[model samples]
Target: MVSIGYFLSCEEFGPRELVKQARLAEEAGFERLWISDHFHPWNDEQGNSPFVWSVIGALSEVTSLPITTAVTCPTMRIHPAVIAQAAATAAVQCDGRFTLGVGSGEALNEHILGDRWPPALVRLDMLREAVEVIRKLHTGRVVTHHGRHYTVEDARIYTLPEQPVPIYVSGFGPASTKLAGEIGDGYCTVMPDEELVRTFHQSGGADKPVQAGMKVCWAPTEQAGVDTAARLWPNELLPGQLAQLLPRPRDFAQASSLVGRDAVAKQIACGPNPQRHLAAAQQYLDAGIDELYVQQVGPEQEAFFTAWSKAVLPELR
Candidate 1:
């Protein structure tokens, strides 16, 4: 049976609210938890982006659910060494219930440091080197690396898990799938596109765990859900392009406003029934996603979780 989880948006809630959500998720029987590691929120209206590592520590104290970075882009904004240290600490904090999810980040977040963002190909190369760097350090060995992306000497994770923390790679396309297969202990993605899983396996991620996420707005009726989704996720309507790729949440919001929310509603599944939610997840599941994470938009989070836990998840469960 496939495990299910939720996307805790650090960009949306306060620390107290976040802890409450974690407790609620655990109480609701979510098997695992995933969080966004963003530096900003898509809109000022959205209002937050707490440091995810700190939040993870909080989550550990509040629930027994395993935590994983739904996706953390380490190849650009932060050096792999920093990620290794953070991951090690998180692993320790969670008492071995943490997995590090990583990827090649976007300019929106990385460019804050005044560095030009590399093209996708170059980003992939940098990611490969970053992964190598993280892996070596995880060995508890003092590593000195002169690689394409980083340079370090005698670096080691003095406090690490009895078992090495698993590294999960996030990928949207074929080349990345291959990269994940080659280096990731598992894979994480936003869609459960099975072909992507096949691509992942072919690339080198054989027998790895897969994770996917979707958005929903649970209401007594479908129209309310649709309206809520339109307002919040108007970004879904933008033509598939780089704006969708910008790392800054404000950039994403700006792009969404330009594209308009009504247009995005056409693409999102803000439906009245379990079937629509199931359909929403099926595409990603078919894509070989091993875990499906759901994020509910609008204010009825408790109701949304109840409905999904009772109706939609049964089929997958």
Candidate 2:
């Protein structure tokens, strides 16, 4: 039996709404939660991006469901030591039900600090070192390091859970997958590509949980859902490294203009049909993902949860 989770989009909702949705998600039979960490929305239509650590703190008070950053970029903007401290406190708050999911990062978020975004290869190297720094701090011991990409001076995490928080790594390609296998307690990615999972296992992640997530739009009608998804998340259809390379929300919006409603509709499961939603999730399960997170895009959160609880979740559960 695969575990099913709800993905909270920080880019679309404010802190209060995210907490409320998390509560509703638990009531709707979801077993866990995946929250996105971003400094900016992918496009203007998505609207908001709250500080994720604060939102996670609020989530601790509201829901018991285990939470993980669908992926956070701990390499840039924020130092690994800071992320380590934050994750430690979050683990204690969540009663040890927290996982730290990190990635190399995208320019859209990292560029806001006025730092030049390094190439993907360099970022991966930074990610590896960052993971090491975080792990050392999580041991509740003072750490000092001078590495190629970053330097840490006498840093220690004071608040830690009884058990050390598990760190998961995310990847969209070969290099990152191998890194995840090498250092991650778990693995995360958006696509349900079995080939990637196989690579992860082969590289060193054998038997580790592989987490996957996807987005959908569920509304009264297929066209309504399609339009909503296209308007709010057309960036989903942008190909190649566009998602990683784009430096700002407007850049994404401009690039997304080329994507049509039909493309989004085809890419994302939409409408009232439970079968469509089930089939979408089934792909991840069949691909051997241990955890499956589903996000209902747009403003129909209530409808999406209500419908899924009654119709879709029962079958999947």
Candidate 3:
């Protein structure tokens, strides 16, 4: 059976609201949690980008659910050594129920520091090295790494959990997926691509946990749900590397303007239909995902949780 988790969108809600949602998620019987780590929301209309580490601390006090960052980019905007310390502290706070999910990252977040957004291959290489640095630091030994992309001199994280934090890598394409398998303790992605899962297993991720996240909108009516999803997350429909290349929220809004409500309705499971949500999750299951994280797309979180707890989670389970 696949474990179902709730995806707390840091891009959409404040820290307190996220903590509240974590409580609701646990009360609704969601087995685990995935929180997005972003410096900025994809678009301003979605609003609210709280520092993820602070929110994680709040969540630890409220819910016992295992939590994972649904992809943090440790290669840029923040150093891998710092991320190692944060993840280690988070693991301690969560009593070892935390996972560090990392990725190559997008320009929208990583470009904030005025660093040049490298090509996809270079980003993957940097991610590989970043993971290496983080692991070395996690060993509680003094790490002095002078690598091609990063240099860490005599950095040691004094506070760590009983066990080292598990690092899950996120990938969207073949190269990144292969890299994840080679380095990640687990693999995470947004799509239900069977081939990607196979690539991970073939490259060295065999029998490791595979996690994926999907979005849904639950509303009183299907049309209302569609409108909310389209308005808030049309970036989901932006084709190809557009999501990776776009540097600002306005760029995203401009790009997403081309995405229509019908497109969102067709892709995301919306409104009161439990069957639609189930089908969406089933797709990920069919792709051999061991863990599935679901994000409610808009503000109808209370209604969504109530319906899923009563109608959807039971069926999925």
Candidate 4:
């Protein structure tokens, strides 16, 4: 059976609310957790981006559900060595229930440091090296390295879990998917593409866990759910590399303006229909996902949790 987890959107909630949601998710019977790591909200409308590590620390105190970063970009904005320390601390706090999910990041988050966002291939290479640096530091031994994309000088993580934190690499395409298979302890993505999952398995990730995240909007009415989703997460509908290429919340907003409500309604599971949500999740299960993380978009948190616990999650199980 595929594990069903709740996805906490840092872009839409503050640290305290995220912690509260983690507790609620546990009560709702979700088996695990996935939280987004971002420096900025995709648009001003989404309105928040708390430092993810701090939120994870709070989550550890509040819920026992295993947590994984939906994806953090360690190649830029933050060095891999620093990420290694933070992830180590998080793993200790979660009692070894934490996973560090990494990826070749989007310019919206990585470009905030005024660094030039490298091309896709270069970014993938950097990610490979970054993961190497992180793995070295997680050994709890002194590590020093000079690599093409990063340099670590006598760094070591002191506060670590009894075991090394499992690192899950995120991939949206073939090259990165293959790299995740080659180097990652597991694999993560946002889509339900069966071919991508197959590529990961064939490349080297067979028997490794594969996780995917999807969004739904649960409101009293279908149209209301569509409106809420379109207003808050239209970026989900933006095609191609736009999500990766856009550098600012406003840029995302400008680009997202082209996304219409009809598109979002068709793509995302909306409203009170349990079958719609189930069908959405079934796609990921059909694609052979080991874990499926679901995010309820907009502000109907209580309604969403209540409905999913009673209607959706039990049925999925």
Candidate 5:
């Protein structure tokens, strides 16, 4: 059976609320968790981006569900070796119930340190090297490496889980998908594209897990949900590299002006109807997702979780 997980949106909630949400999710029958890691929210309206690792430490005490970083960029802003250390510590804290989900990263988060964001190919190369560094560090041995994009000098991770933390790579395109297969222990992506799942398996990720995440708003009415989604996540409707290239929340908000409530409603599962929510998750399952992660887009997480626990998730299971 495909596992159902709750996605903790760091962009939308503070650290305490995220921990609370994780506890609520476990009570509501979510089997796992996916937490986003970002230095900034997509737009000002989302209003928050807390340090995800700190939040994970809090979650370890509050909830027993396994956690995964929905996607973290270990290539810039934070060095891969540092990420390896953090992931190792997290795994130990979570008692080996952690997965490190990584991606090439967006300028919105990576550019904060005054580092020039490289092109997509270069970022992927950097990500590969970073993953190599992380894996090397996880071995609990001193590692020294001089690579094209990163340098590690006699570094080692002292604390680790008995089982190595699984590293999942995120992909949005063909090249990334191929790389995820080649280098990642598993694959993480938002879309329910069967071809992408097939590609991951055909290339090198056969029998590995593919995780898909989506956002929904369960409100008193459809229009209310649509409005909330549009106001908070209109950037989701932006096509192509706009999500990667837009450096600031204001820029994203400006671009998102073109995205209408109707467009968001059409794409996201919105409203009080449980069927609408079920269908959204069903699409991902049909596309061969091994794990499904769902997030309530706005602050109505209480209603979403209550309704899903009562109605939606039982049917899905």
Candidate 6:
């Protein structure tokens, strides 16, 4: 079955908001949930960044749906050993409904450690090492690692679930996508470009669950929805494919403001029509992804959910 899901926005909601959303999502018949792990909201105007791990912990108590950090960078700011431990505790708390989704990370989230952000190539290497480290520690046995990007000796996770948490790796372009296929239990991305999925499977990601996401704003008019998405997610248009670069959230917000609404609208789907919303989601399903997590961008969450559940979901099902 194609798993349908939603992305919990840490950028606009606090812990209380997340808990309410998680409950509503499960009650709405969504199967999975992904939450953004960020120390900073992309923009001050966007306003909200509750510590994600804490939010996830509360989610364990409130919902039955599985949850994952849509993508967290274990190699920077936080050590992979710490992530392994956190994942273990989270897995136990959630009753096996947790997945550790990882990525190379960006300056917007991971650059606060005062270290110069590495290039994408180096970040990929670091990501591999981080994954390896987390995997080994998840076994609940002591591990020692001395890799090109990480150094850990005698680390272990004591409170692990009976089964190790699955790790899903996120990628933006071909290189990281292939790396995710080769190293991850699954591949995750924002764009539903099937070619990227093909590249991953060709590189040995066969049977790996593919997950992709999109943002939408349900409104009375197409332009109204587009305008809301642009206002909240203008960062999508920041030049130079920033998913690979940029080290600070402040920088992200600043760069995003430099772009215009028309430019931001080109990347996201925003419309008043249910057909357009369904079409936007179809792009991900057609890409061979195993899951589609939609982020409802405007204040019309209940309406968006009602429309999607009534109009789009049966077709996907």
Q: Give the clash total for candidate 6.
A: 4
Residues 250-311 of candidate 1 have per-residue lDDT tens digits of: 77777777765455455566755888888877777766677877777767878877777788
Tens-digit per-residue lDDT, 1-317, candidate 4: 88999999999999998998999999999999999999999999999999999999999999999999989999999999999999999999999999999999999998877999889999999999999999999899999999998988877788888999999999999999999999999999999999999999999999999999999999999999998999999999899899899999999999989998899999999999999999999999999999999999989998899999999999888
Candidates' lDDT values, in order?
Answer: 0.79, 0.93, 0.95, 0.94, 0.94, 0.85
TM-score winner between 1 and 6, please give it.
6
* Candidate 5 lDDT by residue in tens digits, 216-289: 99999999999899999999989999989989999999999999878999999899999999999999999999
- As for candidate 1, its clashing pairs are 11-48, 42-249, 181-204, 181-205, 192-284, 193-287, 194-286, 194-287, 194-288
lDDT value for model 5:
0.94
Pairs in clash, predicted candidate 5: none
TM-score of each: 0.93, 0.99, 0.99, 0.99, 0.99, 0.95
Candidate 6 regions with alpha-carbon error over 4 angstroms = none
TM-score for candidate 6, please give it.
0.95
- For candidate 4, the TM-score is 0.99
Query: lDDT tens string, model 6, 250-304?
Result: 6777777778887756667677677777787888888888988988886777777
Evaluate model 4: give its lDDT.
0.94
Q: Regarding lDDT, does 1 or 2 come out ahead?
A: 2
Highest lDDT, which number? 3
Candidate 2: the clashing residue pairs are none
How would you encode candidate 2's per-residue C-alpha lDDT over 1-317 as one tens digit per residue?
89999999999999999999999999999999999999999999999999999999999999999999978898888998889999999999999999999999889999988998888899999999999998898888888899998798988777889988899999899999999999999999999899999999998999899999999899999999998999999998899999999999999999999998878888999999999999999999989999999999988999999999999999987
RMSD values, in order shown: 2.0, 0.8, 0.7, 0.7, 0.6, 1.6
